[model samples]
Target: MTARANTVAVGYLHALLDYARARGLALDALRAALPFDPSDRDARVPEALGAALFDRAAALLEDDALGLHVGEQVRPGHYGALGFVAMNCERLGEALDALRRYQALVIDLGGVGLKRDEQTCTLSWNPGTDGPYRQLAEFNLAGLVTFARWMAGAWAKPLRIDVMYAAPADTREHTRILGCPLRFAQACYRVVLPIDALDAPLIQPDPAMRELMQRLADQQLRALPRGDDWLTRLRAQIARRLRQPPVELDAVAAALALSSRSLQRRLQAEGLRFSALVEQVRRELAERHLADASLDLADIALLLGYSEQSAFQRAFKRWTGQTPAQWRAAHTEPRN
Candidate 1:
């Protein structure tokens, strides 16, 4: 993992540890089992190691939906200076704009983009050089979606979340975690919600806080470090795995040099299950296949871990609420 990836992973782990402590989990025991010093603010661990830790935590807790809980734990206040910006922004759009403007002050692996349609607003990511893990990516996206929804509900109307990701194997679990429509793939990774959501005023609307946060964010942006290529590595790993069928969790874990159980547990702690991550990978592959005119549906299905086309069809419907063919038709427009 690159420095950026390390920072993101560390921040996520920190959040998880905080949650564990609050939940009465044996933090010391879990910390001791981890590879890096949890207390060391500058401690840098391999991205793979960070991922392994996430997996181990999830499995150890025996909570397949741990990611959802983790998402819920992220509050605007948790982001420190960034939190201040979010809290003080006049509306959801302003807050998101602030996030987009200064996210690099917090994480380096990616940047976020806000895309709006007549009925929906989509927050998408442009992965930085150090590519991020699908789980981490999902966790980050889900956390933002959950936070936005909570904020919106507190202020005004609630927005429904729509997640577009690289599909995962455990479609059921992914649906359960998101508690909304989860599209495997069509184009980019995004969280879609109604445009009306932007109108919701933040609960903590203070112009002074917003100004203070803006100043703090400006300072942090100037001092942030830039290194590591985790996002690139993650993209390569996904592409490679998709090209090769039946990519097992254990194989991925072994490549990272950790026990399968440990890997699963750590991912759980980060708010991801291995199965969900795998499905995300598959969803991306499916989208790629669907976009290629030459690749038949059956062939794409086999490449994406489905034993048969029928199974793939069922999964596709569950993922997008539309058949593969239907999704392709809707998304095959020329971009300007």
Candidate 2:
């Protein structure tokens, strides 16, 4: 799974899967669609597919600030070796610096950049190439800030959260997740911290663990494949537009602010067809939606933008060789 540079660590996927299951989601449907063993903690997956799965989880949960929730939930173990490396650093600054270098273990998309002023030391994320990743960017930075607080103590919340996009209609969730006021339509996505927090000692400093985690992280990095930023962005867009049916090539292009012809040319360069990507998104979401027993097949069909239940059934059959009910019955876990 970690063969391609385009892949993401399966730990991230597993976390989302766990989150969904805790919320009473249908785990069987997710497995039937993605077909991965939950026990494979070290597995890697294509970043696009992973992003699509994450997006699908968000849609099903109906939480727009789901990234914030995910970020705030980050514990040292969730990041695997990288988390181990970060948490073991002696100082918060060293932890942040280590995170900047080893982040590829958790995510391959972005890097951390630092800027210091008289009062605040800004930590900004240089996001991988742009698509609709505002939520993800926020999630990553918020998690980093949370880790920093863990090292520096819980009172050390960020002073500011500079988000690039327009302010979401609801700021309450952001306030709760970030524990700070947000600055919308900013130059980019970055968080501000009072400079003194950097020197705070970690609660559990371990130089020996840091060395071990660093070596393990390097080995994991070597095992991952090369990536395509554009392709990941395209797939993420496809996931988002699933709720808005008739997910056509042109519509996807328009959403990304490109012409249809240009979109095709780019996808062709990646050896992808837009139609194929649409099917991939729908198939993934169909499995996700079907996981919620309260959500019948008819409701799922509409969510996937199908005009009718019959059309969705035909497509699901063609894609999986079984009806949604059959797939769910086969994959769903037995009740206790």
Question: Which candidate number has the best lDDT?
Answer: 2
Q: Which ranges of candidate 2 are over 4 A from the true structure? A: 1-7, 31-38, 227-336
- What TM-score would each prediction reach against the true structure? 0.57, 0.60
**Worst lDDT window (10 residues) for model 2?**
125-134
For every model shown, the clashing-pair count is 37, 3
Give the alpha carbon lDDT tens digit for every residue of 1-336 in model 2: 122344567786666676678778787656544656667878776566666666666787888877777777777777898888888877776676666556777776443455555687666653334444555565666677777777778636888888767877887878877888888876556777787767778889877677678779878766765444455466678878777766678877887788999887665433345776677567767876776667888899888888889999999886555899886665454355
Show where candidate 1 strays beyond 4 Å. 1-6, 9-12, 40-49, 128-134, 154-177, 185-187, 228-336
Q: Write the per-residue lDDT of candidate 1 for residues 232-329, one digit (tens) a residue.
A: 33334555776466677777767666678876654543334455555655765686578776788989987876778999999888655579988676
- Please give the distance, in angstroms, between residue 281's alpha carbon in candidate 2 and its true position after superposition: 40
Estimate every model's Cα lDDT from 0 to 1.
0.60, 0.70
- Where does candidate 2 clash, by residue pair? 4-225, 5-225, 5-226
